[model samples]
Target: MGGVLADGDRVKAVVVKSWMASTGGLEVHYQDGLEKGSSLKANAIQQGLEEDVHVSGAQDMETVVHRPAKRSKVQLGSAPPLTDSARLLARRKHCRFWENSGDEMELELLAAVGRNLQPGTDSILLGTDSHTCNAGAFGQFATGIGNTDAGFVLGTGKALLKVPTIIRFVLDGEMPPYLLDLILQIIGEISVSGATYKSMEFVGSTVESLTMEERMTLCNMVIEAGGKNGVVPADETTFKYLEGKTSIDYEPVYSDAQARFFSDYRFDVSKLEPVVAKPHSPDNRALARECKDVKIDRVYIGSCTGGKTEDFLAAAKVFLASGKKVKVPTFLVPATQKVWMDVYSLPVPGSGGKTCSQIFEEAGYDTPASPSCGACLGGPRDTYARMNEPMACVSTTNRNFPGRMGHKEGQIYLASPYTAVASALTGYVTDPRDFLM
Candidate 1:
């Protein structure tokens, strides 16, 4: 599906199954631009196409799925149960809510829904968040759609598209020491917008070797590079990750052996090094060592990119071995509430001792009050340990763009969790190798 086409190109496409329904609401659409055709610009007062379409969006639908089986009578990691207020809203909106399911990010749940739970042909995951591309790791044609597209999708269950040029990354070695760093380095080299409106198809031995979660991490950042989506062909790892998660029968899709591409990138694990994106832009990259002189005011070690177990393992190696307390306020966040639970209760990092959460606490860090998006993408400057004063931060989040985590004035250095935890301990951007045992 990694194809490039003109802006107005159209082809015959069909929606085998329809997902969300935009039955009501303001029927909001854009007021201008490429999406002008999609926008309705309607409000309760205005008479537009919205009223003729029956108003609200995704409200009270039988087909829409709710996550975690609705009001799951379970909780974890000091996380509060689904509040009655939240339940009331979900009930009114008719949207699926994974109340107390310990999932902070909906990507996994959505992936399970689209790829496994209710597998179907010509499936697309329309999400308000940009990370909807995460589903592409399952070899699905997934991407974030603008509000205009949402209006159209709800009406017809189909979308018009400009097929993007596909860029392929072929690797032939074992995984690197810091795969997160590898992705950072690659993106830095390509620079943001290098693949604008293009697709990134990861292939080769190393990609195949990566676990589904790792592969998702690799592809999840494609959007950060200004690509349409990043995907891996369905393989053994895909099947294993989906086993028992879904019983739906569906056909898997893959690229051709001799598939053509707009460009190809080759890399060997032996030669790559850990890297970070300096302030203002993710593409402004440098090795962690190169930016060691940059002092850090705080460290953030969670996000979809950094909150996974694999990411924590790298941080744990550095944190556990150093056996020291952090000098600055460091926010330790797990991508999902389930990840929070696993870190809180389960022993990890191939070492037996305190739980991951306990270790972080002993190291003088606070678990996110709730397993929800905290301090990422410009969270409230006052709460969540967000940086208000002008300071520098070493973060494991996907972006280092101006004011990403907190105050726009704060400088953010985007790096791996390994680098972030180490920098927090040293009170500066310290190299992870200096701390890891």
Candidate 2:
């Protein structure tokens, strides 16, 4: 079989063709045997027809699969329909320890692969989810790709990528209680296309002070700014988070002192205040306090960006400080089963043995729901806490586009957990300082 495999020019052409084919349902196209013009087309469809293995959320459990049983047509399958031998092989490759229900895809990836990621090595992580860049916080080269690239990687365990220019953002000074505002500030300044197709490397005294979860939060939103990926160099915090998660040996990588960058920007964290992105865009920024008159009917605290354990802890801290009942319908959704367990089990730091669940209940909020993407994705009309009717909401989720949480006219204000919970208590876009002070 004389065909293209490693030649750069040939590979680029093949990749482009494959991407074009993906618009019509094919994820990848590979030619075998004599690879000349018309002859190459014969085996391309057959290659894509073969089984593919993908471990995903429950939402994709009944996804359609192409199989000959229905004339090779796409039809719903309980799993990725595979031949007997393929099924056995997939079973062997599957790791049940990495499986979890009701978790966002990026969260699952971080739990399974981030801890084992080794920088300065050939280790590469790619996924179909745009937020796959969240893994870059581990100091590894990770990025999101279309299904065509994902399929290619699935088959060959390799991908062709161009080196992206780096734009470093150096954060310094005392860290604010709410870090979401920091990212919102960057996106607001750069607009949506400021860092298109480029890597945003974060490094500074403040970044070094962040927890692993906080670092992931910073990297996760890089996609919002049209960044190819975002990275935070691995440090004691990164290693500490990996301690019980993996026993893999790895070397941490850092930018050389003399490294070149496309651009460098710095910010003083102490001068910042909680910020929010108004409805319709993630970069439509405004100070959280400035929006105090923006009455809201709901508040949501969940999603890969905001539904983590630390996110819940922040909300609990706000509620503990306020000591007031919520005036609006507040919804809570943990990002994963681990987070759900933490909400029910882990004690809030200053609450003196009170769990988040207890604090939320005392604040007149409903019990936190099970782990899932929840209303952030604007699921079915029956989705829990979905804004079935047009309403203004303060949410901890990343995006706040129209109809994102459900109703077309529904408004979403993207804020930190503290702001989200505070708004829930006041029925308006209130600042956390009102309570925390």
Candidate 3:
């Protein structure tokens, strides 16, 4: 099943975000092989197992994965090395994949795919994690598939998919109390299934004004609404952001004047407020004012959606302006190690105006040793930042399903960075305006 596309199929690219060695379903196959002491070549794709050392069933099949190399500059082989990838594991380790787990996983996978992703290439991402759609932010066709399908793609380097009708959303408005709440507000208007099996493309001056990290945050959640992918066409903003980030030399892609859509919506966000999703579902959203009285036992301000520099900047600004440390147990995690350091560079007003990270550390906040999607799945008994006892939390991470944060008995309310920091300061669901100086 080499790369091929039928007429009328809308997909234009493929992204493979697997072999990271931990988390998601691939963990089983990767870890099993490690336990069996099966080593791999330093630069090999397959482990050269005689009979499926770790992968079970059809995934064990042998096939040559013909990754698209139409462009000579695209890089592959960058994902975090499995613990026992080869005899040279120590020399070729890429744990960056493991460090940035849980959300926007496709971003790191792209680095491993090649040295530079050529512009104007259509691509699909094969992975079990639904957040794989995050790649669409770069103007490529990307989405998620199951583990068996991943294995098949690994062998064949091809996949079949239904062409999804495109839906367009034009955001026209000023920044809300918090820019991060914008997408959650959009989701509240359109139920999670509203865009089922369709593409949702974001455009408008408001969207163009945002940074690349913010755009990725918007595309990353398309899967949460059951959409195939979300995209922002490559433009000057995109080009400038990607300039040095990749070595690809190809034409950029964009939407056309005659492009048709299955549906369209425009939101004038001047009236938008900070909103929160009540425990249980992403679409179960409401104005933060409605839940202002709700108390919380802890606060979480990290994830692909929350870990970006702009995100932490907003939360830090809130803390600095208010001059308050959290009243609750606030867990601060940067999406990446670089981000961990970035937080320390942004000065806060408290404790003589140290960087936000220093301010939090001085105020006794719990900073996890490493950044990973450790607690976002919370069903695992040992997930970091887990709540074993009955409690309430305000998290910026996606999903609040039963036991998502390790305690079915606990409740999670999803909010923006501003609201999350405001709640942490008060130990209650809060409106940032109420605490503003």
Maximum-lDDT candidate:
2
lDDT of 3 by residue, 1-437 (tens): 22232222221112223452232212111211122123211222333222222211233222222222221111122343443343222223321222232222334334222223443565444456787666666666677888788656655667878999999999988766554787788778898898999999999878877777777778878877889888877778777767676665657677789999998999887767788999888899988889978989999888767766677777877876777778999887777655666787866444365777766665567864466665767756766788888899999888887888888877989888889989998888998877653
Cα-lDDT of candidate 1: 0.67
Give model 1's TM-score versus the native structure: 0.75
**Where does candidate 1 stray beyond 4 Å?**
1-100, 107-109, 112-121
Candidate lDDT scores, in order, read 0.67, 0.74, 0.66
Q: What's model 3's TM-score?
A: 0.74
* Residue 102 in candidate 1, Cα distance off native in Å: 3.5
Q: How far does residue 57 in candidate 1 sit from its true spot (Å)?
A: 34
- State the lDDT at 415 in candidate 3: 86
Q: Candidate 2, residues 1-437: lDDT per residue as tens digits?
A: 34422212121112223432322322323322213222112112223333332222222323333222212222222333333234334444452123223333453246323554665456766767888888888887778899898667656667888889999999999886755567888998887889999999999998998887888788888999999999999888777777776666778878898999999999998888888999889999989889999999989998888888999999999888878999998999988777888999999998999999999999988789987788987989999999999889999888887888999899999998988998998999988888887
lDDT of 1 by residue, 1-437 (tens): 22322233322211112321221222222211222123232322112232222212322321211233323211111222234335445545564544333444654435632333222255555666677777777887678887788667655657887888899988778765544576687688788988898989888888888877777777778888998888888887787778876666767767777878999999986677677898888889888888878877888887777777667666776778888999988887777766766787777655676677777887898665555556777776565767778889888888877777778788988888888888989998877778652
